[model samples]
Target: MPQFDSDPVFCSLLQGSSDSRGSFSIDMMDYSHSEQSYIRNSPVLVTVLHDKYGNSAQITDFAPRFKQYGRVFCPVMTIRQIKPLNGSPRICVRLRPIYEYGAAIPQITHGSNHVRYVGPDMILRLTTNYSINAILDEIPVVLDEGVTLILGPDETVPDSVTEVGQQFLNQTLDYWHDWTRSLAIPYEWQQEVIRAAITLKLNAFEDTGAIIAAMTTSIPESPDSGRNWDYRYCWLRDGYFVVSTLNRLGTTQTMEKYIRYLINISANSENNFLWPVYRINGMRNMEEQIVESLAGYRSMGPVRVGNQAAEQIQNDVYGDAILATAHVFFDERLEKPGDEVLFRILENLGEKAIEVYDKPDAGPWEFRATKRVHTYSSVMCWAACDRLARIAHHLGLDNRYEYWNSQAKDMHKLIYERSWNEKLNSFVGSFDGNELDASLLLLNELDFLEKNDPKFASTVDAIGEHLKEGNFLFRYIAKDDFGEPEYAFTICTFWYIDALTSLGRKQEARELFEELLSCANHLGLMSEHINPEDREMWGNYPQTYSMVGIINSAIRLSTSWSDAL
Candidate 1:
C-alpha cells in the first residue's frame, strides 16, 4: 500500500577537479559499458569503474532469489558488493531513502556496522562491511578490498555480509540459468527474446499471480498531451496477452498461475458481470484521484494514482478471461488441469458474453465518454462462445458444445451484418460507424475471419492506410474524449505485423519488425507509446502489452534452429 519512487543509494567519486570555491567539480564520467547486461546471464548487475590513474573497482548488485526446500524464496532485500581491482579507489556513499511518497523523512539510527531508517509503516536496515561512520556521515573512504552492503527489513542478517552476498549471488545465478535452460527460445534474437521474457516475468506479481500493466504512472503519451494514466494495477485484457504470449515460448508456469487469478476473479463476480480491470490483490475498486503533492512526469501535472477505466463496461474481458482459462484446460503440463467445476464457472462468463456481444461498451481503447458497439469487442464476444464450444467438445459434453456453438454462430452473423463497411471496403471500428481503428487488424487472429478472406485483407490494408505512421501504427486518427491521439500505441504495430505475416507478406513484416525492435531502449525494453515524430518513448515503462508484442513477433518471425543447422 505505500507507494513512492526514489533512488535508494547515490555514490560519488572523490577525485574530481576543484573549482575556485575549494569544492570538487561535479564532472560526469564517460560511461563505456552502457549495455544493461546481467552477471552470467543472471539477474545481477555488474559494473566496473576505472580512474585516469591505475585504480579500478567493481560493483555488483542483486536481489537474492533462489530455491529453498523445493520452493522459491525471494526476499525483499538487495545486496551490493564493491571490490578493489587495482590500486585504491576513493568514494563516498550517500544513503538516502524517502518514504510516504517523498513526504516523510526517515529517522536514521546506527550501531557499530549497520544503519536503520525507521519510517511510519516500515523500518529498513542497512548492514555493511565498510566503515559505519563513513557511510553514516557520507564521508570519503578508500576501497582497498572487497566489501558488501545488505539492505532489508529491520532484522539481523544472521551471517557475514560478504558470505551471505556471495551465497545469494551464486544461488540466484543458478536459478536464472536453470530457468533459461527450460525455455524454448527462438534461434535468432535469442538475447532479445530472453531479455523480454525476463522483463515479462518481472512484471508478474508472484504472490497473487496478478501481472501489472506497467511500473510507473502519469507518463504522457506525447509532450504536454495530458494523456497520462496510472498503469500499476492488473487488467484482465492485458493479462491474457502476457500469459498467451508466454505460453507460445513453452513457459507455462506463469500462465498456469495466471489462470488461477482469472478463475478467482470470474468465480467471485456478482451477477457474472466482470470488470475490465482490478487491483493487483484482486480488489474491484480502483478510484481515480490526482495527487496534488508531487509534480507530474515532466511537470505535466494531474498525477493520477488510480485508473477510471476500471468502472467502465468492457465486454471483451469476458472473452479475455475465458481465452486465458482455456489454456489451463488444454495444456497437459499443468499440475491442476481445468475441471468440470472450473468449466461451469467459465460458462457463466460465456453467458454474460452472449448478453453483451452486440451491446455498446467502452471498447478496448477505453474511451472516457463515448460508448459504441465495437467490432473488436463483438469479435471477442463471439470468441468466448466459440472457445467454450471447443472446450465443451474437448470435455465430451455434447449438449454444452452444441449450446455454445449455436450462440457463437448467431453472434458472428450479427457482427458481420452490422460492422462490415461496404463503402470503405473494410470493417470499421464500431457497428455502423465509418472510422478505422487499429484493433480491427485482429480480425484474422481472433478467427472471426480467415487469412484468405477478402474482407480480412482489405481491413488490414485499410487500417494501415488510415492509422499507420511510417512503421508505427496509431490506434486511431479519430477524435476521442482527449481529442485526437498524438502517439502510436506500441502493441498495435505488432498486431499489424502479425496480420501481414498471415497474409503472406513475410518480407515486409520482417522489415517492419526489425525497425520496431530498433525503437526499444538500449536495454531492449518498450513503453506504452512511441512518438512518431521524434522516435521518443512515452507512457509507462516496461509495459506488459509492449513486451508481449516483442515475444510474439520474435516467435513468429525467427528462423528455426534446425534450419540454421
Candidate 2:
C-alpha cells in the first residue's frame, strides 16, 4: 500500500497483513453517504508479531451482534494462540484515525485499557486489554485466545473483555440463526433466497426504516469507467422494488418501516415533487463530489463520495413512493391505517406527475448528459395515478378514484401513441424515438400492459434482439459521455426473466435465471453490474435491487413445497 499519510487513510482486514490492505472512503460533499462499503476503519489494531522462527498466533475479528439491544454494537476482535513453538511471539497494536472523509486525522489520548481519538467530525474510543504505548509503537506483543478489543463512541471498557466477547459471539449467531428460521423462503432456492433477504435486511437503516441502494461507493461500474457512484443513499424507485420483494417473502416489517419513511418525506416536501434519493437519516440534501486525496479502488483516480442525482427530477419516484405505501392501505395489520390525509398527499403527487409526465427528465436510468421524455418514466407516472385510483377506491373515496383514474388513462394513451414505433416493432425508449430501452421491459410489471398483449410480446422481442448480450441485458446500448456501457446491468436481466415467465417461456427464462444465479460471488451475493463476458460481479456490492430480483424471480419460478424434499 502506498503509505501517503495525508489526504486518505489506508485500512486492512487482517491487522498485520500489508498485502490485504485497502483505503477508506466517506461521503464527501459531492458523494452523499459515499462510503457505503464497510464502516470506518477501527482506530484500534491488534496483531501477533513472532520473532525469528516466525511462530505466532491468530486473531478472529467480528462485530458483537445478534440480540438487539437499545444501543450496543461493539465490534470485538479476539486474538488466540495457535500450535507454535521455537520462537518469541509478540503482538502489535496501532491507533491512526483519518476522519472527515480523510480530511482530518484525529488527536489521541489514552486511559487504562481505552484510547480516545477526537476529531471535528466524530469522537471514537478504543477499548482493549493491551498497552497504549505498544499500540502506538506498532510493536507486536505475545498474545493468546483471551485477548480482546472493542471500539465505540462510548469510552466504557468492560472489565472482562474476553468473557463478554465470547458471550456476544455465541448469542449473536443464535440470534441470526433464529431470525433466519422465520423466513418464508421458497422450497427451491431456499438458501439463496434467505441469504439475499438477510443481505437486504442489513441494508435497512432500522433507525429510520430507510433502505439504501447499496453499501459501497466509487467502485466503478466498470474498470476506469468513471461510472463510480455512491450507492449508500436511499432511492424511492429502488426502494419500491426492495419493499415489494420483502413483502412477498412475508417480511412486512421492512415495508412498514419504509412506508413511514415515505410518509415522512412527503410531509416535509415543499412541493409535491419527491426526491429520488435521500440520506438514510431522512436529511434531504445529497450534493455529490469527488475526493481528491484517496486513490480509488485499485488506485483509480477521481473517487467520488456523494450523489448529486438526488436533486434531479426522476419522475418514477412519485409512483414508487405511492406504491410503497399501498401495502398499509390494504393490510389490516397496520397500526395506523392509510387515511384521507395520505390519499390527499398522493393526489398532490399525482398532479405533479400529470404536469411533468410529458416533460423531459433525467429519467430512471439517470442519463448524465441529456434529458429525455423516457417511456419508462411516463409509464411509472401512469402507475402512480393508477395505483392512487386503486387506493382511493379501497378507501371508498369514489371522487378521488375517478379523478386519478382519468389522469392515469390519459397518460396511458399519450404514452402508447408516442412511444410505439411501427418500423422498430417495439415501444421506443422515448417519445417519437426508435431506441430500445430495457426499462421498457417493465411495461408488464407495472401492469401498464398485459403479457398477452401482442404489443408486449413484440416489445420484449425487440429489446431481446438489440439490448441483450447473450443472457445478460443492458439498460440501453447507446453511447454516452463515458462511452458505451461495458457490462450488463444485472437487474435488467432479472426484469427479462420476469417478462419471459409471464409470457410462459419458462424454459428460456429458467435457463437465463440459472445463469444469472451462477454469476453471484461464492457467497451468493450480487452487485449492480455484471461483466457478461467474464461473468464477474461488478459495481457496488450487496445490491438491494439485484437481490430483490433474485427473491422475485425465485418466487415467480420456484416449484411446489413437496419437491424441496
Candidate 3:
C-alpha cells in the first residue's frame, strides 16, 4: 500500500483511561490509536491493603467482548491475586466509558450504586459490585482475588474478588479448552498448533467472519521506519488464505461469513472489479487519512487510518477469491451452498483475472513506484482458472470445466515462459527482473509445481540462500519506497519453513519452525515482521498471515497419528 494520506474518514472506536503510572491517557498509545479520543465510565481496579495490625497498605489505582445477550455481552474481565507473603490486601473498583471515538469525553452522573455515563451518541449504565462511596470517594478494602467480574444490569457478585476472579478464570479456561478440543489438531506440536489456532480465531471478526490482517495499525515494520500502514481491513488475498486455513482445521463458520462478505462486494463492484481490501462490513469506499490528533506508535509521525492498498490493483485476488469460494459449491451444510449463481459470479472475477494478470498493476507487495508482473500474482491468476475448472467439474458443468481447464493450462504455460529464469535455474519474483522473492517459495504450496520436482527444490534453495537471515526471512532484501526492509517478514519466514519441509528438509525445517514459534510474543501472537537481529516483533500485532503460516507448517510437519500416538 502506498503511504499517502488523503481520503474520507470513518472513525474507529475504543476505550482508554489514565492512572498514576505515568498517564494511561497518552502512554498506552505506544502502538495503539492516537487520533481519536473519548471519555466514559470504565472499570477501575484499586488494590487497598488492610494490614494485620490496622496498618492498611496504600491503595494504588489504574484501569481497564462481543455483544451477545439482550444487554451488551462485554468481556468478562478477571483479576487474580497470588497469595501475598506480606500484606493483607483489599480491592476497590470503578467504572468509566469513553464517547465518540474518544473525540468527546462522556459526563458521569454518580449514583448511590451505579454510574450512568452520558455520551454524545448513546447512554451507558455502568454497574459496580463495590460500595459506590468507596469507588468514587477513594475508600479502599482488602478482598480476595480470582473472581470473574461480570458487568450486567442486575447480577450478584462475590464479596471476595478472588472468588469471582478465579471462577471467571476457570470458566474461561474451560471454555477455550472445550473449543480447542473441537479442533482437528495434529497430535504432535499440539501447543504450537493451538496457539496459532487461537490467534487465527481472534483475528476474525466473529460477528461478520471478516478476518483482519492485524489488530493494531501503524506499528512500524522496522524501528522508526515510518512504514506504518493501517491493516485493520479485509484483504481478499489475506482472506483467501484465512478461509483455506480455517477449512483445513474443519471450521467452516468463518468461511460462510467471509464469503457472504465477498459475494456482497463482488455484486457491488463494477463489473466484478475489486480493490485488494475492504472494511469488515463489506464497505468498499475507504479513504485513507492521517490521524494527527494522536501520536504515532513510538512517536512515529503521521499515524494513518484507512489503508491505501485498497486502491491498488493486486491481481492475485482473483485466484484468492475463487479459491476461497470453492468450498461453497461442495459444502452442503452452508446456508447458500454453492450454486450456478455463485459460480457465474466467480467466473466474472476469473475473467477479470485473465484480463489483468498479464497487465502491469500493483503486485502482492503493492509497490507503487515500481510495477511488474509479479510471479505470485500471475500464479494466483492461474490458480483462479485452475480452481474454477475444478469447481465446474465437481458441479457437472462439463463445458464450463473444459473451458476453465484449457484456460488454466494456457495461463500456466505462459507464466512458466515469463516467470522462469533459466539463467538462475529458478523462478524469479517478477517477469521484468531477477530479484529472488520469498513468495516464490509458495510454488509448491499452491501446487504450481509438484512437491518432488527438481525445479521446486531449486527455487527453495534459491530463496533460502538469498532471503534467509539467521532463522527469519525478508520478503525481499531489495529496497522499496521506504528503503531496504530492516526486519524479517514474519509470515515469509514461516513460509520458508513450510518450503523447507516440503522439499524434504524435514530436520532443518523442523528446527527453523521451532525457532519461528519461539519468536512469538508471550501470548504466542506475532506481528507482521521481526527484528531478526534481536528477535523483537515489529509491524502490526497478531498478524493473520503469520499465524496461518504457523498452523499450516505444523500440520505439514507434524508426525502421523500412528507415530504421534
Kindly give the number of clashing pairs for every candidate: 0, 18, 29
Which residue ranges in model 3 land beyond 4 Å of their true spot?
Answer: 1-87, 90-103, 117-119, 122-125, 131-141, 144-175, 331-336
lDDT score, residue 37, model 1?
Answer: 47
Model 3 RMSD, rounded to 1 decimal: 7.3
Error of 1 at 417 (Å): 2.0
TM-score of 1: 0.92
Ten contiguous residues with the weakest lDDT in model 3: 21-30
- Report the Cα lDDT for residue 487, model 3: 88
Per-residue lDDT of 1-565 in model 2, one digit per residue for the tens? 0111112233322112223323221101111111112111211122333344454443444444554565434342322212222243444455566654555667887887777777774566767666667665666555533455565564475567656656765665565566566677887788788778878887887667889898777777888888888888899998899888887787787898898888888888888768888888776766788876456666654566678788787888888887888877888866788888878877888888888888888888898778989998898889989999999999998998999899999999999999999999899999999889999888998999999999999999999999899889999989876889999999999999999999999889989999999998756789999988898888888788899999999988899687757
- Root-mean-square deviation of every model: 4.5, 7.0, 7.3
lDDT sort, best first? 1, 2, 3
Candidate 2: misplaced stretches above 4 Å? 1-61, 64-96, 130-134, 141-143, 562-565
Q: By TM-score, who's the top model here? A: 1
Task: Give the poorly placed runs of model 1, Cα more than 4 Å off.
Answer: 1-35, 50-56
